[model samples]
Target chain A: MKIIVCVKRVVDTETRVKVAADGRSIDLGGVQFIMAPYDEMAVEKAIQLRDAAGTGSVTVVTVGPAAATKELRTALAMGADDAVHAVVEARMGPNATAEALKQVIDGREYDLILCGKQATDEDDAAVGPLLAAALGLPCVAFVHGLTVDGRTAIAEREVDGETERLDVDLPAVITAQKGLAEARYPGLKGIMAAKKKPLETVACDATGGKTELRSLELPPARAAMVKIEPTAAGMQSLLTALRNDKKVL
Target chain B: MAKYEAPDFFDLDSLLTEEERMVRDAVRDWVSDRFMPVVEKAYSEGYFPKDLIPELAELGVLGGNLDYADFPRLGPVAYGLVMQELERGDSGLRSFVSVQGALVMFPIWRYGSDEQKARWLPALHSGEAVGCFGLTEPDHGSDPGGMETKAVRDGDGFVLNGAKMWITNGNMAQVAVVWAKLDGVIHGFVVPTDAPGFTVREQRGKHSLRASVTSELIFQDVRLPASAILPGAKGLGGPLSCLNQARYGIAWGVVGAAMAVYDEVRQYGLTRIQFGKPIASFQLYQAKLVESLTEITKAQLMNLRMGRLKEAGGVTPYHVSMAKRNACHHALEIARTGRDMLGANGVAGEYQTMRHMCNLESVKTYEGTHDIHTLILGRQITGLDAFGAA
Candidate 1:
């Protein structure tokens, strides 16, 4: 089955960022970009399925400015069969990004569409279901266990703290989580081979959306952390502090 | 054959964290199922298992040591474990990957020109291009400064002449990184194995390291263009650094051999009945088995710390020298002791101790001789230049 996994180019999780002058925009200057952590897990899961089956092709799709190609190449390096980069000439958020990806994936039929439940930085988990609704396909939201047989995908997703099993139809959309699979590192050979693999970029028409903000803003700073001691009296003191000064009780 | 209990926490099947444990177990599985069965037949029969190299490459087991935190793996300790398992099957099998990953691919990744790195590393990493390091000459083994491999200035290129002794994988190597004394300076030459005037003859009738493809290399009037020279390398330090890098790997590798041998003895002592009871019931057998565990643990911890220190940018030649000496010394002793526990069968080809014992004799002697490391450590502990201008 042919599949397209949507990956986002984001700051590496290890990066510590200072908020930009504008509230909603992040200060990105000189920061290193990597495939989003959860997205890498999704990519690994897709590639693992494709490799294990030994018959299907996996195409990685990313939409952003010119710099988005780096994420596509990284996915290719991690063993994606090919890539389709929806080049956005203008700035785009999740809605536009999903729209652009849907447009690119529209002309071609995909067995399944995989994405992360949420981008770590943004915490928006709407993309998979959004794309599923747009494509008019069944949505497999927050899927943690996935396996393919013939054309159907057998998967389980957590609902109300209990896992609900489902046999999703082909051409469905699923968001992957950490439990899906441990990610694979790009070996030296794969990194070299990635350079030769096919990456096709097509111009994406802007199908804009309605969530407009007058200004970008940053959240308030996190409270400073204080060390806690482990002795009995120290532990009692810590409990009192948590109930009193910290107000965590 | 003795039953194996948990193999002293270095079995790798037990040593790594769960995720990393899976990776290590995968390596052993591949080694056992794919490489091990084919190795002895190839080595004793004097053939190189050229096909298996790519298999190793595919698993990223070849130079899989390059650090990346996102996909954490068993590092130097596991690397040592993998190499040891392969070498336990046969030194030739281990050397094929080692020479490619540790000796050749490592240098290209670290010191080659951009185009060279882009060109050679991927091919070697994938097992398409086989590489052999040419540093030891007929005259020089440990002290490569005494090397007489000559590279004379000729236009934009150089002509090389000199013979190399005991080159592992030399016959089957498609490309060789030959170290030569250029003018009065030392330089590394990436000579094609099929380069004009470069010839290799496999040394025959070997009692030790018989599983490996070892050869005496002759480079008579061999010419290489200036582009063939490693651009980022200079001086005797260039090749010595490579040897130091390789020796660190060997130090870790020998510990693995020692562990396997020790494990064999431990199992043999428990099963082989003598005096109408198991030999392991004897105080003497227990002593040998316990000693093997103790020393192997020390070496395992040492190599693990060495790997951490290396990743932290804290490695020195002295640390590796100390490790190499201790591990090789203990390995040789362990092999001999393990062989005794097996009695007549140890010397027989049915078991692995005597073969390991024989192969380790060569391993201990190469990279840096055990005695040479003793002096290198002596120089470190005491401010003495023993192997100095005399």
Candidate 2:
């Protein structure tokens, strides 16, 4: 089965983020970027499915600025057959991003399309459902496990702290959850081969979407710890403080 | 915990190719995620992290630079980068890869017969069969040309008898690339560890490179067929060539150690308060950090150029000796400065600066000692053998 995985590049989770001078964006100076963690799982799952079939290709597509090619190349290094880089502005919303992906993926022959449940940077969780809706195909969100037999695909999704198994026909969309698959580090051979793999760069005009940003700020600092004595009256005082001062008794 | 910030004052990443950067990053991430967590335990307990062999093989680190059918052959620069990242985690880890690739698999690929290559290369590449190089003997180290190991011609095979000391992976090796004198001339022999009369003893209580395995190998009347001998290696040149390959990697590897120490001390100094301010505010501490960074940057450039030249088949043994000598000397000094900069906290295991400082002592002595390399370069430059007067 042929598979296509959609990925996004975001600031590395380990980096200390700073709000930009303009309150609407994040500061990009001297920050490192990586493929979103869940998206890595999606790419890994696509590769596994392609390899298990023994006669198929896995292609990764992304819509971002020119620098997104790094993440696309990383997907190729992780054993993806090829990559599609849709060069556009980095601030594209979910709808416009899905439209750009659809424009490129429309001409491809694929039995499955996978995406991360959400981008770690934005935490929008909208791109997969939006893309599936626009393509008019069945979608399984938060897929934890998946298998394919002939024309039908079975996906195990996480819902309300429980697993829900769903079987869908071929040519369906799936958004990978945390446990979908563990990504593998790229071997040196794969890294060398990735450079020779086909990477087709296309100019995309899909820019604006319905969502708009207002402002961004850091979370409030945590309150300092308050120590209480171990005596009965101290316990009573603690309870009184919890009920009276904090109002959470 | 904060992420490791590799010191790159010279913007060396800009000079690297995409493949080089990706390869380095892959190993760096692996070291951070897997190796760093276990390094202290392994070092304190004095055991090599043998379980990581399969993972390293999966990452294509073993035999990574050889040109076998399935091997990566990632070129010298990429291989050097792999060494750099591994050494950044710990010297013992890098030593394992060096011994496996440059010393063991390389000789088999370059000199062994087709049958021998087909037999051991795949196994070693996959980490199914661990291999060790047996050339440093009890009586011979700096001058391996005078090795006393004998391979007496007997029937259709040969009977070997000798002892090799300071053998890395000796206790765990399934095969050994042994160099012995055949009719008073050096020849390479591939000996299986399970052969009769072959014995291995692990050395204990080492203060340096404690996370690595070091053993003494004894061979008493061990017999091998004629096919066991490497067909192409005829003299000391064979083993010396392998040392050159390893030294090229060492030149790059030690820079990683220096960078690690430098980065650690720099971070610590910035936050550590002394005299009502961060200790980094002092000019004396700044001098140490500045010197460390400068030497590491120079070492990085030297190794990168050496790797490129090696890829182009233009690197000489003299050049490798120079790079190895210079890099090791400066790295050791930097580790010392970093250890002292931490003051009372330097000796604690919580900070890896002292661990790196101890490991560099062995790195300075192995492959080729800093002084030996200096003599080799001295002889090359002046066309005079420094040892001839003796």
Highest lDDT: give the candidate number: 2
Across B99-192, the per-residue lDDT of candidate 1 in tens digits comes to 8777786676667877777777767766687788888888888778888889998888999999998888888788888888877788888888
Second chain alone, TM-score for each candidate:
0.92, 0.99
Per-model TM-score on C-alpha atoms: 0.63, 0.95
Regions more than 4 Å wrong, model 1: A1-249, B1-6, B9-19, B66-78
Candidate 2 chain A: 10-residue stretch with minimal lDDT: A203-212
Each model's iRMS: 11.7, 0.9
Best by DockQ: 2
Q: Report the C-alpha lDDT of model 2 over B288-315, residue by residue, as the tens digit.
A: 9999999999999999899889889999
Error of 2 at A151 (Å): 2.4
The Cα local distance difference test for each model comes to: 0.76, 0.92
